[model samples]
Target: MVGFLGLFAHMAVIGVDTLFAVSSLVISNAITRQIKVGIPVWFCFAFGFAFTEWSNVRACWNDGKEGIIAGSAPVFPLLCIKLLLSWMTENKEAFATRTNAGDNTTITTSATSTSSTSQTGDARKAGGDINTNSKTGDTTKTGGEKKKRHLQLVKDNPDLEYVKEKAKEFYRKNGKWPGRPTLQRIAGCRENHARNALRELKGAS
Candidate 1:
């Protein structure tokens, strides 16, 4: 009966250590958005505890000393991992909030300017039917011409729109838009799309 109790204790220790390791990996990945960097560390610490516990189990099985592997050994590593994950989560939240706020301000200003320009244009065209294509020399201002122009713009400025959309999506997803530098790194824009957009908005105003 004593030997059976000892075996149960050994199994219990192993089970608890395994659970700790799995939980650490899950929490770290969720907070850090890093599966590659976090998973390996989790495995390393888990294996370390497992190694020590297995050694103790073997010793017990051979009629050697039991309870040599203290619960504290695995508990310490688990605590450290949890602390690191918490720090990462806090940082991510702060950064996301700040980025989102800035992006929202910029977007709001641009929208207001654009809306003013559109209002002015509507007032001016109350009597005169102003033809949009007259200024651009786009004689073929039909649906086909408009579609072609839209496609051409996308083809010419492939990365510009892509970067803008990505930044917008990032803000939507994380509640923080990416900085210009990060957008440049990811999207590789040569000219400033935000500045161009601002100019267009001002013209419309």
Candidate 2:
């Protein structure tokens, strides 16, 4: 070791070797980064060109698909066009269904609003206007039920028994219990409120 180090030529050679190794490592790192970026680019170009050539063959030679004949169109263009067309075709029905569902939701909201409005108008049932067969057509017999069934009903027909008496008077005057219109004018209870109370009484009996 001492004899080799003592030689001036040997010392210069060692320094040169160390410097070359470091330069080589730096170059290799730079080349590695370039290769990483270039590989994907090269692959894309190669695949695109190869597929284009293959498409040309299919267009000329007549690839054996069930519907297509040879030389109908350029193969590459046909593939691109069909790819987009098929995607639209696949989603068409789903889009239609979504549109219909939105319409249905709007219709349901409209119906709900209509029902609520009609309920307000229904608050005027005369006692005789009730139905025997319909459970909802029953009347509020006692004063408590007429007042307690619903807050809205209590507000409408504050005097439940007065309405009852009016219906009885109607029977004497007209020979029949007052029907829906008469009861509505007398008691001012909505159809639903009167009907629910009557039903409750009948069920309890």
Candidate 3:
């Protein structure tokens, strides 16, 4: 806990708007929304600055407080690296989710296109001119099929993936995954299913 708080204070002292500071804010917020719940970045920096300046007096330095004040410098680069690593891991998960969603959409669109093409051929055989009405109806039918497929995807969503995301969010806010009672509250899932989901998430597979 001390190291974490020190990291936040170190980030601010460097420069609140600097790249590392900004990245710290992003990484911190990804895990914690309420500054009160976590460390208040701006306030911590201000406090650290004030403390350092106050301790810089000749009397305080002679008392050996300067060594502690000077310790702040090294933490700056280390905290930046920590924040960047957290961001990279979170970004990877987010990107994977988007890729999965896009794949599902692509599959649905291709199905619609294939169904439309098949209907178009049938229309040409049955009439002097291809039946425009038939093509339109086929398009609508494929659209409904796509909707059903989308719903199915959600219903069949990998339980581990769903639970992992919720668990990560909960951990960010509270610094720990919920045990039995609170787990379902954060997950918004039924108790039995949540347990099953937990197994999948925790499983080797």
lDDT of 1 by residue, 81-147 (tens): 7687778676886889999999999999999999999999888796345554463455655666887
Worst lDDT 10-window in candidate 1: 64-73
**Candidate with more favorable, higher TM-score: 2 or 3:** 3
Candidate achieving the largest TM-score: 1
lDDT of 1 at 74: 45
State each model's C-alpha RMSD to the native.
36.7, 24.9, 42.1
Shift of residue 180 alpha carbon in model 2, Å:
45
Q: Tell me the TM-score of each prediction against the true structure.
A: 0.28, 0.23, 0.25
Off by over 4 Å in 2: 1-81, 124-205
Of candidate 3, the 10-residue stretch with the lowest lDDT total is: 51-60
What is the full ranking by TM-score, best candidate first? 1, 3, 2
Candidate 3 lDDT, 2-64, residue by residue in tens:
243577856644553354445455546654333332356546544554444443343245546
Q: Residue 109 error for model 3, in Å?
A: 1.5
Give the clashing residue pairs of candidate 1, or none: 117-204, 117-205
